[model samples]
Target chain A: TIVQTLERHFSLQDVLVGKSVLITAGPTQEAIDPVRYISNHSTGKMGFALARVFALAGADVTLVCGPTYLITPEPTIRRVNVRSAQEMYEATAAAFPKAHITILNAAVADYTPAHPATEKIKKKEAEFAIELTKTVDIAATLGTLKRPDQLMMGFALETNNEHEHALGKLHRKNLDWIVLNSLRDAGAGFGHDTNKITVMDRQETVAEFGLKTKDEVAADLLSIIVQKL
Target chain B: TIVQTLERHFSLQDVLVGKSVLITAGPTQEAIDPVRYISNHSTGKMGFALARVFALAGADVTLVCGPTYLITPEPTIRRVNVRSAQEMYEATAAAFPKAHITILNAAVADYTPAHPATEKIKKKEAEFAIELTKTVDIAATLGTLKRPDQLMMGFALETNNEHEHALGKLHRKNLDWIVLNSLRDAGAGFGHDTNKITVMDRQETVAEFGLKTKDEVAADLLSIIVQKL
Candidate 1:
């Protein structure tokens, strides 16, 4: 019975058996100086979890990561470490051609200092400002460059007009699917262990799941992706 | 000059002074027995972040929480801890009378065991299933019970049809605003440290923010809410 249950839920394992999956995790740092930089609070847990799931499902996984303290899941997964958004984009793009599925999960800095100072600016009597420019849009670039058969997904975290905004991104980025989250939802965002999610695809089908651990959500999501393929 | 520059970009002090806010955080555990129960992957970081932001803004904050490892943020901020979704509903209803703004951030479990096991069931070779029943919809319930002057927010995490579904939830729940997220987007969900978000209101206004620390996003969101007020 146990075997039957497992088989029933994961009957499509053959679909991912030889596929190469790539994932990006953590947040990029945009340096202002040697000691000061702009960054976000991503811990890379979700991306790590996805890597584990893909590997378990028999896909060759390449996890491109920013600086994170979380341990890589296992020796079977190939890991590439990077820091700034520029580096992350280069690493991801380099691996994209070989991947059957690519998940861009890094909380990359959207902007970087136009010119990074060599030393940390001293706090003098006067204030200072740093000019900034938009970082490369890795997901959009991938979307535009994707082959006909490659599966692409994007994520959106919204505080207001959540759906309208996510839909806009879905069309703008040419995503096969998109995930949406809200800051208004407690226990849902960063620095937590569990998540509740709704899955959206090009078909406009919506599937909602109750709160589950990131690992569980990753497995469930991968299952859907497998079916779609 | 520095102060002027700070004010020009964003003024943290001016955004939250006169608001009355209520927030819920952490995971609610539904007891099956005296020592065991059912729960989810909510660590309460997002809700706690909001509590800190609202408190810093000088708003009276009443935090309704579940079990978590986080330190309570403010000494004056009232906190009510509960073990189940039902208890959360009651606590939130009690705090509702005094609040002008409410953020439902808890990832409340959608279902509870129909009959909690009296003791940890010993492992058996045979398969087993536990019955489940729906938990109360805290946000929807609050929306139905809210005062006209109060602003209510909801969250939707979708894998597909990301935006239309969130918009549907906003109207269905009678929310003043809704936040949306998708897991397909990296760096956005549970157990991470950074977040990127979009905000949607009943007025159909949408605001998008780049990847940011939860604290920074909280500040930005509170600023927007204050403007609406």
Candidate 2:
């Protein structure tokens, strides 16, 4: 009782003083040329929201991000910007070993131009198809290295089979918790300020949440992580 | 010579004093919920560039846009922001008849949720699919109402059959000009500061331009339109 009261009286800093978190955010660009690339609509809002929440709670955060207009939400949160899936993987891998919790939130490209042209391709023919090759799966790759003490999380954004896909990814990636975003949620996905999410665990337990601003959602999400930690 | 000198001396406003231009920019969202949507990676950069160029050149420009984070480029240029393909179509339809030149630069959704749920959909089932229906064709809809002297331009961004698709769109949509953005072009597609394009006319005249900043490309495009005018 004394320890609990002392901890509460000290500050939020006392609660999370030694905890470290790593987060991956935004959309990775798959370059087709000097002027062309493939990417998603992620604006890095949710991840940035999470970073802000974690930083305010006195946890050290490292944010590895793709191309976005956003700046670091707090001075304490370290930021690393990357352009492609490969670059994101490298940065995340480098940061993973030092963190107690790792959240995979980036919409990294699944494929990239097989042969990006050196020069601008001209309109010689009426039709064309740029060959695409699969990219490295960042989550699965990092999952292999996760220790029992480290908490690993993954996110799934799906148009169909949302729960099945999320559960499958959770097991396959060895994630402790998986956040699922459904396109069926009208105001919940990409570029929006609000989100409704379902958090699934490795044991297949699921907790559904209501539509709320990403800031509120982030706090809710961090509380879940804090409980398990 | 004296008339030309007088027009030049008066101001840029004197040159395009009577010209009215309307542009559509950004990616149209197909809502599935109050908090979620289906959208592409259009940032409204190209359309905004065109609007900026026209406004600076002294033309009265109206910009009907979809959801994007970009701010209005110029104060004098009219701006309208909308979400969903239906909203975009209605706004564009209302503004179509008012301008002398209309440039359809928006990446409007081809399909939308056939039945959007009002409440946040709970993931009870393991697998599910959202049925989608075709959205209104913004370019073809306005093309039908084009006047003899009015110039209508369409933009086609394609991965396959670039020229053939663009040519078909030019005649089918009754566009005076069609700008083609091929994924094959190294630096000529979405979310990039630069572009390389091929402009095709209804008469089958094709003009190819090298990679350049969107601002420079916009100037080149406006010059091409000026020549025809």
Candidate 3:
């Protein structure tokens, strides 16, 4: 522990000194009404970890995050806070052109309330249904706009057919690499400080890592990205 | 501020000594699936404040709270952590018979997903509807079970017709007193340290209070309960 702490403080990897990085973090809260909302379990630990790692490596990082209580990880990092998926897409897209590398890490909701009530909806009916409409696909949209010199990556969290789902997403989003997180792994997904991840490329080359703290995972991800860069 | 702190430390009002108090606080999250949920904007500050006030005044407090990041207000106060409205109801009802006073302060969901998926529901259809069923009325259910010696109070948060809605709930739930919070008030209600409340009794005795810190509001509510006791 002491050695790790010492290493973290003493290590200065400035490989990305002139590079600009874009990252997204946290879960988007889709409003159902003034009082109620639809949200997910993402706490933004992984995304925040990535931002800290990138910032420490001397990159100019801009973090576009959804609703989360986590403070900005680094003082040098530019933080943009948004509440819904649409806002996240706009913010990320705006910063995409200037970024050398972009990481779509936020767990953006796939659907939002079709009609969010202005006031709190009173409980009158015995049975009620909430109509939801699909949200903009941030990664897919940005993927098409990515320049040849720019690198883009994203994360895939799956409960079933982990490998197949991740591969499909990597190709569909046109990401250079995709990080996979399986919920079946204990102490590995949302809310956990530790994570076990698998990195996959278009070539279907897969590199799996053991469970480690989010900081360590971030470092591993950075190491891979830096090599490619 | 120093004078108030000194008073809080020096004041030893043990009027509620040996009496058990039941209090519920925070917003219940009804599961949509493993990763998503439906929730409201209750931070549990008011409920935690009430727990602190009651505990300091020597009441044996059992605080049944929904998912919140807030820590236990007092070491002596028993805390029962719950996630959904159903869980809150079960936990509260189990402790009700022994409680001399009960305060229903939580923003319990009136509806819950009829079928929460075992796995994360994939985003497939362009439009989706989440079917919801009515949740058990914790206040009204417990109201019927209240003994002659016991006192029951509840909170009403309204967006429109505040007085009329609160009165209707107070009578319908058979509450001894109802505290109303109208969303129209700035810097008041959910997520704020300050609150503006109107306390009303069964006989229609209304006591309106200016915007005050949640702790001060808790003290005011306790004073009224102590008088009735």
Candidate 4:
């Protein structure tokens, strides 16, 4: 069991073993052309780390991801590849029903080009505009569909008013818990290996953490999930 | 001389050798949190490929880039790393004055959160509205600042009215050339290694090429630059 390797005396041997875990990672690509897209810089590091952690804890992990250079973290993990947000939604939706612990980590595009060009667009103006439309809300959908006994965790990476927004999302989405990633700290944000986080639960309790490698953050999150279970 | 490696009889040895070139690659990140960001999926392949192509042609290249998994293609390339659009603008602006050939290829976000929250914002509602404002127009600024003898090229990745929009930008930005990446072309766009490009000059002459590796596209683009020189 993964507990044998942990420094702490507390073990999640019974809680985690045989659990079904669903993790979303990477960034969704929104097409503007056959050759161009709007996307985020989610490298699948944190989410993939979580998937690995869960798998190590004897859980069955299903990782749904966007385009990336990184591969699935372990042999026991099942991976689903996707590009745009719509595709991610479909994949996640299918997997959510069976998941015991679901974590939403992918930086899904909030909006996409309303009408992708069918031909190569040539520029004639100094400034131009591309019509955009809101993408499907994947997290909200899963939050609503989750069973009472299931655990659903979400992440809110925000700047100002971070706490209030995250708290609101926790209730609005009916999530059991939410992790807040504050960009105010140095060496944090897209592509960096280190992250600082503050985890909040239903009773408004918070567990704040310092800067740590993505791998460490994964362990920290999984430990918290273990306690919750 | 890269001419020896070319399959075509035409050569650019005389025009490219020792020339100064500036190119921007990758995607600029807009922070929403200390750990989350709004960005695109620009792998820096095209810009880095341009830097490599120019260096192989004996040009002194300054490559400005955003966060990515890629490394500078060559040792001789002077690389400037940045995250946001403002940082990219400053780096490009600083390098543009000395470059004989300037290419703007970075997929910079046009708008960022007007005032990012200082703390991690939690969700309180189903739909969240993040106020945004436009970012600096790096190409237009450089276009106006460029010397008459200098050649500048821009890109227009659009969904509709491609030619008209690109043409307007050329004249409005006073650019010497512009490259259009059409989404209508299959095998082109954000994640693919192949690109199909349409080149338009100040005189409105157009050159179109089919899908090819980013490396080949770099060479083709350089050939056009050589002819213009």
Candidate 3 per-residue lDDT, tens place, A1-229, comes to 4226324544555778999999999999999998999998899999999999889889999999998879898899999999999999999999999999999889999999999999889989999999999999998998888899999889998888889989999998889999999898998989999999999998999999999888888888887788788
**Best candidate (score: lDDT):** 3
DockQ of predicted model 1: 0.01
Q: Is candidate 3 or candidate 4 better by DockQ?
A: 3
Most DockQ-accurate candidate: 3
Candidates 2 and 3 compared: the better one by lDDT is: 3
Scored by TM-score, the top model is 3
The regions of model 1 sitting more than 4 angstroms off are A1-8, A12-15, B1-229
Q: Chain B TM-score per candidate, please.
A: 0.89, 0.92, 0.96, 0.94
lDDT for B222 (candidate 3): 85
Stretches of candidate 3 above 4 Å error?
A: A1-11, B1-11
Model 1 agreement with the true structure over A1-229: per-residue lDDT tens digits: 2223335568645557889999998877666554345555567888898888787777899999997778998677999999889999999999999888988778776666778776434333222345667778898899889998898777666556767777777877788777775555678756577776777888777777787777777777787778778
Ten residues in sequence with the least summed lDDT for candidate 4 chain A: A1-10
Q: Write the per-residue lDDT of candidate 4 for residues A48-105, one digit (tens) a residue.
A: 8888878877899999998788878899999999999999999999998889999998
Candidate 4 chain B: minimum summed lDDT over ten consecutive residues — where?
B118-127
Worst 10 residues of 1 chain B by lDDT: B120-129
Identify the superior model by lDDT, candidate 1 or candidate 2: 2
Clashes of each: 35, 16, 0, 43
